[model samples]
Target: MKAGFVIEEHVVVYCDGCGDHYSEKDNESICFHSIAQAIAYFSAHSATVGWVYDGDRILCDGCIATLHCLQYGHTYPDTWQTTVWPLGKLTRSRSCAECGIPEIEAQS
Candidate 1:
């Protein structure tokens, strides 16, 4: 848990750019680390919720899913992108486990 370490005052998390959360190892690649923590945190917090990233500091589980899709790819009802903003809108709920894209009306 917590990036192979313990949670403490020094263990900084939460990326403001995309709201992706991660542990602080006192380095530059904060996004990748935070993405890892986001995944675990959401998994424990929400069985259906997961985390993704956008190459910057963003700890939001919603962001994580988007990141996953960016690096990989995603699919949906086709009309899904109509309501949400690109890279900002997360899977409404549990997305295709493979794509990580949320259902049009689901919550990530």
Candidate 2:
């Protein structure tokens, strides 16, 4: 005799800002067993991870940072200081003029 089983459907939440979803496995979007589960998960992790989950919309960390920079603008210096590594890799560093945020970028 064959056994019977049930397959259930779940909801997947996506970020409103970038259209990306959270994934615990890092391979695919997370599937919540129910809407309550999704809400609970987001409520627990959102604030700590810089995610915005306001029931209707979700925003990830990168999107939040980008939005902040766009609204206020980055105050990087006019010229970035460049450094050359032994292996010929080049990097540039600068501090924002307004907020004094340090930024580093690698050049290819």
Candidate 3:
């Protein structure tokens, strides 16, 4: 008779931004049995998933968005021009800011 030991493998994903592992509510790290499974899961849940695997690195949603904004440009609320109407209405507008983007806001 031959005796053999069984070994299990798990893949732990980490966020490049915060240097934290993907975790559940109980703080348990989310692990996958294989790299293919990890990639498939992330790809399938990309929209609702809070983290992203951006080819070279894994990043939290906020970090990825911030990186994109830094590379392209983003709008700031403080940069928006706001006006208040006598009827208690508010309007804000910013055209072609540093990001070359236009924005408008209307409130009542």
Candidate 4:
């Protein structure tokens, strides 16, 4: 007779900016369970005011906000024009089926 222990393991993807790890079960849009997904998402969109996952890490919300502040002197929260205007005058380069939707709201 033999006794053995079985341990279940979960893989987590880490956000590059904050080093925060997220699992597949986590419903947060900012994090992804796979690095390939993160890379695909980041490379697909323009880094105007949203999250970007570099090859190594997902530059999380806080970091993106910081980048905006550093580059433009203020954070444009969920501003469509700021993000859209630069994409060759509101043109999406590729099909946006896999792209995550930006949280849209009026900027006060």
Candidate 5:
């Protein structure tokens, strides 16, 4: 089995034409080292992110590649845009869908 590598700080990686994590914006293939570095930085900080995979029997990777973007001052948590609702959050206040008889309140 091939072993995965952990990335060190501030190292440069060149693509090996596997293109698994390759992007046209990068103008070359993606390599394991570059991906490891990106994964390290991303996992270090808390962020809501997503990814896609390609190719068969071969693996490659990439990342947002911003070492200090959030540190430079971004507002709020990563999931802030998800919009949770508090309409039925009150305890025993007759807010449930199946309690048609009405709720007498949790303290009752």
Candidate 6:
């Protein structure tokens, strides 16, 4: 009896500034049953986390939550902003189903 569907998600994070991407290259990308679990993972590793939508990129649930927190005056730990530029903003635009991050309109 299959009551629910099993979703296999592969989340990837890319640093828009440096073009560095993180994924399952060596099993580093974590797996979760729900978006909450994914958000927890990012909260734990927010230090090196980034939020952006390049091309055909599916943001992990955590990325969206982190961005939302930042936009809503949520302060991050010192380590989270360690490498961040003195006056650099997190990202230009993005969107999330769970969070209220603004969505970027597609250009014609």
lDDT of 3 by residue, 18-82 (tens): 78777757878888999889888888886787788767777876676667778877755567788
Worst 10 residues of 2 by lDDT: 18-27
Model 4, C-alpha of 106: deviation from truth (Å): 27
RMSD of each candidate relative to the true structure: 13.6, 5.8, 8.9, 12.7, 17.2, 15.5
**How far out, in Å, is residue 87 in model 5?**
7.4
Candidate 6 has its poorest 10 consecutive residues by lDDT at 76-85
- The Cα local distance difference test for each model comes to 0.50, 0.80, 0.76, 0.50, 0.34, 0.48
Off by over 4 Å in 2: 1-6, 75-108
Instruction: lDDT for model 5, please.
Output: 0.34
TM-score of each: 0.27, 0.60, 0.53, 0.37, 0.17, 0.24
Cα error, residue 92 of model 1, in Å, equals 19
Candidate with the greatest lDDT versus the true structure = 2
Which candidate, 2 or 6, has the higher lDDT? 2
Q: Where does candidate 5 stray beyond 4 Å?
A: 1-20, 24-65, 75-87, 90-108
Against the hidden true structure, what lDDT does model 4 obtain?
Answer: 0.50
Error of 5 at 82 (Å): 7.2
TM-score of 1: 0.27
Candidate ranking under TM-score, highest first, comes to 2, 3, 4, 1, 6, 5
Residue-wise lDDT of candidate 6 within 1-108, one digit each (tens)?
A: 546887556544444444445454473754466655555655666556444343434354456566667677543222221223346534233444445445433322
Best TM-score among the predictions, by candidate number: 2
